[model samples]
Target: MAPKVLIVLTSQATISSVDKPTGWYLPEFAHPYYKLAGKCDITIASPAGGEAPLDQGSVKMFEGDEECQKFLKEESSLWKKTEKLESFKGKASQFDAIFYVGGHGPMFDLANSAISHDIIREFYESSKVVSAVCHGPAALVNAKLSDGSYLIAGQQVTGFSNTEEDQVGMSKAMPFMLETDLKKNSGSDSLFVAAAEPWGSKVVVSGKNGKLITGQNPASAGPVGEALLQALGA
Candidate 1:
């Protein structure tokens, strides 16, 4: 049987402070979803269980990306109805991995969600894969292990960088800088790696069997999916 993978997306539709619409980024979800489509039993889900919103900004940004456009035209329905994150509580064993999709929206909602933390803990404690990209790492911000230790503590990881946030002029608008929070949770700055420059592809894989994985920015989305596949032996 193929490995079962659950892809979590943010439900928050807008960045209220900036008066900008935000949710999961198109490339982040499209790249990964297509990569794992035929190889795994994949389910797209969100905190609210209904339609998970899309970041309109990503649509304009990735308008020329062939794969991203393909997904938008054909597979857009995949996110139209998502399973509720709560529905999977205590069911981590049923899946081989959990992937969090990224966008600025996750920084606001998933970052502070107790249920998101609990669900991630369920997957992590089960020795299953816990992965994310860009702002998706927001889901892992304060998530702790059964021992009460922050999950990312002592774990090598990467996500949307502080510089990237500033480059986009969203640093002040974001509730917290993803890179900074990840470093804090990691208990050190060196553990939170980054690419040579902003908007570059950087994926970090840690933990036994490379179960804990993360990507630095939108450019790293597809590679993160590939890493997840390799980790699952798929």
Candidate 2:
């Protein structure tokens, strides 16, 4: 049987200051979707049950990649039909792994949502792979285990770096900076970063208790997807 992976996308449809439409980055999800969908049974879910917003930048970023472009054209149906977080009811043990696709939206909602935190905790407690990219790692800051300690405590991880945020020109506009928050989380053993630019960085997977895979930015999505598949043995 093919391993089953649950993909969680940010449901926030608008950017903070500008109020521009934004959700999950297309390349962040598309690169992973194409790679994993072929080898595993993949299911999509979101905080809310309706349509997921797509980051306009990603459409241009992965434009030359035919598979990504094809997926983007059909993303409305593909992501809109996602299972609601409430439907999962924090029961994350049923899947082999859970991946969070990121965009500017995650900084606003993913960490603050009780449902998302619970889902992440459940997956971690079950020893399932927990993967995220870019701002997606924001979701981990609040994930608490049954004992009330952060699941990421003492675990090495990565996420969208402050350097990249500045490059994107959204540093001051973001709700909370991810790098600063992660460092303050008290449980993060150590955090890693690519030596190159955030977008050009590769994925980082740490074997801490379970599996924690993280990508630096949109450009790292393909590598992140490939890492997730390897972690699942898919």
Candidate 3:
């Protein structure tokens, strides 16, 4: 049977702290979704359960990309109606992996969601892949295991970096810097690595058997998906 994957999206429609509208980054979701489309069984889910908002800025930014445009036109329904995160509680055995898609939106909702934490913990403890990209690692910052250790502690990981956030002029607006936070929770500074340049693709896979995966930015989405597939042996 094909591996079952759960793709988690943020329901936050706006970065209320900055009063800027934001949601899941289109390319982050689209690229990974397309990469795993035929290779795995996928499910779309979110904190709010319906109409997970889209970051309009991303749509315009990637408008020149053919595949991204096609995703917008053909996959509207996927993001329009998402299953609530709560519904997946205790159902970790049903999935081979859990992926978090990023946007500034996740910094507000998924990052602090108790439900999301529980779901992630369950998946990790179940020996299933736990993955996220860009600001998506916000979801991992506080995720802990039963023994009370941060899941990414001492485990190599990467996410939206301080440089990228500054370049985007959202450093001050973000609740906390992803790179710094990830490294802090990782119990060391060296565990988190960023790309050599802003917006460059960087994916990190680390675990006893490479089950914890993360991508550095939107540019790393497809690679992150590929990494997840490889980790799953799919």
Candidate 4:
């Protein structure tokens, strides 16, 4: 059988009083989906059983791209009806890798989700390729390894940075900044653009062991997806 890749999404429905639109960032999910769909069986899961929230900004950012628009309009059913993390009956060992898709919603809910944290820890402990992008890394803040250490300790990683957050004007509203939390956790070498705006930027992947890939923003989705595929040897 082909290697299986589990793609986890946040089911968070709201962010700072704004209702989360349904679905995920088109490029973030679609780029990876197109790349991996042919090479591996992909399973989509979320914190809640039903529809996951999509970022409206993402939709607008990629609206001019026809392929992405098609993904949002016609090819988003699997993600729309993703299984709840708690209801996932498969063992973590069944999958060869895991990728966490991010949007603003993740910052609100993914970190607090026990099941999501467990899934991440399971993949990490098993030495599977573990990846996350943007605010998706928020989930890692609470993930602990078997030795009771944060999984990100000493890991050179990047996510939606505090600088990017300020660029997007959401830094003040977010419960906590990902960069600050990552530094507080175990990510000592977290990096991001200090002056660039946050809509889209290059993805960052570091550490050869256990594959920890993180994208700075939506622009990094395709590269991040390719990186994950390369890591999986798919």
Q: Give the TM-score of candidate 3.
A: 0.98
Better of 1 and 2 by lDDT: 1
lDDT ranking from best to worst? 3, 1, 2, 4
Score every model by TM-score.
0.98, 0.92, 0.98, 0.89
What lDDT is reached at residue 39 by model 1? 100
Error of 3 at 16 (Å): 1.8
User: In terms of TM-score, which candidate is stronger, 1 or 2?
Assistant: 1
lDDT of 2 at 23: 82
**Candidate 2 vs candidate 3, lDDT winner:** 3
Question: What C-alpha root-mean-square deviation, in Å, does candidate 2 show against the real structure?
Answer: 1.9
Query: Across residues 16-106, which tens digit of lDDT does each residue of candidate 4 receive?
Result: 3544343356677877777787789988888776677777778888889876787877776877788878765337788888888877777
Per-residue error (Å), model 1, residue 1: 0.4
Per-residue alpha-carbon lDDT of candidate 1 for residues 1-234, written as tens digits (9 for 90 to 100):
999999999999988887888899999999988889999999888999889999999999999999999999998778998989998988999999999999998998899899989999989889999999999999997899889999999999999988888899999898888888899989999999999988889999997667999999999999999999999999
Worst 10 residues of 2 by lDDT: 186-195
lDDT of 2 by residue, 174-225 (tens): 8888877776663543555554655576677774644888888877888888
Which runs in model 2 stand beyond 4 Å of their true positions? 186-190, 207-210
Candidate closest to the true structure, highest lDDT: 3
Better of 1 and 4 by TM-score: 1
